[model samples]
Target chain A: MPGVKKVGQRTIQFANPPVVMATASIVGPKEGEGPLADCFDKIVQDTYYGEKTWEKAETKMLAEAVEMVIKKAGLQTGDIDYLFAGDLLNQTISANYAARQLAIPFFGLYGACSTMYEGTILASILVDGGFAEKVVAATSSHHNTAERQYRYPTELGSQRPMTAQWTVTGAGAMLIAKEGSGPRITHATVGKVVDQGIKDPNDMGAAMAPAAADTIITHLQDTGRKPEDYDLIVTGDLATVGKALVEKLTQQQNIDLSKNYTDCGILIYDPSQDVHAGGSGCACSAVVTCSYLLEEMIAGKYKRILGVGTGALMSPCSCQQGDSIPGIGHAVVFEMS
Target chain B: MGANEGSLLDKQFQQVKKQAQQQQYQQMAQSVKPKQTWVKNAVAAFLVGGSITAFAQIIQNIFQSAGLAQKEAGTATLMIMVFLGAFFTGLGIYDNLGKFAGAGSIVPITGFANSIVSPALEFKREGFVYGVAAKMFTIAGPVLVYGFVTSVIIGLIAYFFQ
Candidate 1:
């Protein structure tokens, strides 16, 4: 465990690994029709989910997801040491307001789509370092809320080009305990911002592919592992195009990801469902990892897996100011118990 | 179209299929893109702009026939055109016309009136002074400043020549 302290650059080896006690996911109707629909804990039929606004619906989703995760873990709200949550809203409003109701020590994060894994790394760090006994890492995003804020209003009826990705309307929460019988967090590799001079806001896959590839390469080098080392390697939200780009980039580095690599963005929804370029949102990785991947691990389908959460760091105002989108990826290795 | 997590072979097959579909979408996007019709837009602008000028001419002639001087008639015609423009904009009819006519409606004196009253109407809910009055020149503010400054400079040049 001594050499496990630090791998190559940007990688960390936790001496005392944290365990995922329980996780839960809640998604809207559009996501309910996806391939991973059966994995979700709850699926609301309406975008508003009985709330007056999309933001409120997202807040409701995250709060309910947190409650579900704690209940599934058989832990009371007071038992949790800290709550780490975030969303796509400005000021991380959904997670912040949800935390207000949960009343736990909170850490608000904004890593765009990478928020789930980012929260995972932070929560694991706190638990592994003896800073906390238990922490909840969660993130959520509503399609309508993200659409109006990031692009045109729903009323505008704007025709999104093929390069445009559908923002996921869902929330996922995970309870990381100091010690538990679940998937063990082995190592984490945090990514740096990688900008490939991509300025088009529509082609998010292209913007984020480089970051995912960078983190994956660094993870492999630091951990002294290859593409085939793990049972599976998954990315956060780099759907079809971005996934292909990652495969190509890794291939150039003499790594073959064609066998065991998949992306959450591409896995959640079916292509025939008309989700162009697949799904992209803070909840993409969160929901997929919590619901689908965790269940598979529990079923003994995957023994060891790596999750690379990728995020596009660009705001609508920044894009209008002609700023290029920079992307980041954070990786966490999970081993089944 | 389908990604299977259980079987590695199926996952690889799905990824390969996904790559092919992506290429198809890229090509489709390029082929189906709407082309900008510059010549058509130019004709529309010219016709609508010229028709607006002709209407102003007719108004000027009527005022002249009523014993007004040429300069006074011209100024009165411009005022009438601006009033008509603001009136149509307030009725919400000008925006519809703009959608249909494109640059045709946007190249007219009505478009100038729209430049002033549209933002005012949109922001009127915020309050009168800070909202409507303040934003009244949101679109026209640059026009007024640049228009007056250029005209003053040209006037000085003309006076010096004289």
Candidate 2:
């Protein structure tokens, strides 16, 4: 309790804020063709990205992102104290493999799509506690790898339902330092695992919306802030269906989020992209935040922003066994002032 | 909106969320409820199915003329067709044929072999035990169970009647 500030039960207000020094985003061909293509640092035209398998390609992209962010921050790989990485693959092989290549002390996290923010929270905590000078927070997902692992093989050419979201193929990395000239993480709210007995994996947007709504309400309560306090409120990978649901849920709680709310899932893809619900996976929020939001913040577009990373905690086995998908949302407050 | 307000908002949030989700699922199900292409699919199935049966008859006749009994020729012909289906699936030709031929390619015993071998090939990376072996029977398992049970029932009825 030396410097720790615990707000209510699940939220924490940091005494010493950690700065996001620099960030990098890399995506595959399909993601490159999306609406936010120009924001990305590198867009590999081929999904393989000069690798033989899609898994290998994802590892390459993540490693390259880590390298890019470190270089952008004017720091060497040795300057980073720890690497926090995660991915959508089984055992998070992509992030683990990238860590192997980077040779940094690694901490692997599994929060499904919320893993990017989970990494960010851990990295920020380590820096704020004065334990680390710099930490690299990274996460990745490949369309091919996720489809085969969570759904079906690409060659099957199965028909997808309208509820199914397109797993984004990309990697996003951020270099967080103990002190820097950048946006500071002021507060964080770790959400409860909320399950509405949602069994359909295809409709993950619906499954995760409740968790996001719960977190949004709890964050405002713990911080004693209003919805209008922040310029923007972004949720991770809720897509269209979940975005609508969040709006509905928040309205019931008398929290009007209609003016400033948007989802990274909906922002990443174009309407003409035929992505059904919208873009998803760990890379959805990661790439959008690292590329789009960071640049906009630097340009003085937003002063205070709340990014809530939402995740559906269910594996293919868990979904197959008739177990309901449990959802979680973790919120982090970013401020330029 | 008071800070002291306990789980009131949480409960309300869940209730509103559940109703919204129910509505969304119903809408999604309605939107993606597959189109009625039964008549066109039936036509395709009839033509392709008849053609496969004709082809198998020709192969059985050829085997019979090669100096084998009718029963032996039929079994040998079926085995060869199954081998052909499996080989085609491995070469990535069977899926393409399934696209064009629809029910034609799938109605034969070769189609059954394709169903079993295709999943095994798809999940080969998951390893031999959990990936390939476990998933190999996903499509064919129900067929095998139902076929066995139905045959047993029919055999018992025939034996009693006779």
Question: iRMS of each prediction in angstroms?
Answer: 8.0, 5.1
Clashing pairs in 2: none
lDDT, residue A24, candidate 2: 98
* TM-score, structure 1 vs. true: 0.71
lDDT of 1 by residue, A191-267 (tens): 99987666778888878988999999999998899988899999999887788888877887999999999999889
Model 2 chain A weakest 10-residue run by lDDT: A152-161
lDDT of 2 by residue, A171-203 (tens): 999998988899888898997998877788998
Backbone collision count in every prediction?
A: 1, 0
Error at A291, model 2, angstroms: 0.9
Measured by TM-score, the strongest candidate is 2
Clashing pairs in 1: A8-A222
Off by over 4 Å in 1: A1-4, B1-162
lDDT of each prediction vs. the true structure? 0.86, 0.88
Tell me the docking grade of candidate 2.
incorrect
Model 1: how many Å of interface RMSD?
8.0
Off by over 4 Å in 2: A1-4, B1-118, B124-135, B154-162
Write one digit per residue (lDDT tens) for candidate 1, span B1-162.
234555878778898886675465345334433344567656766776677778889999999999999999988988999898889888877766564456666666777787778767755555899967987785678888999999999999999998
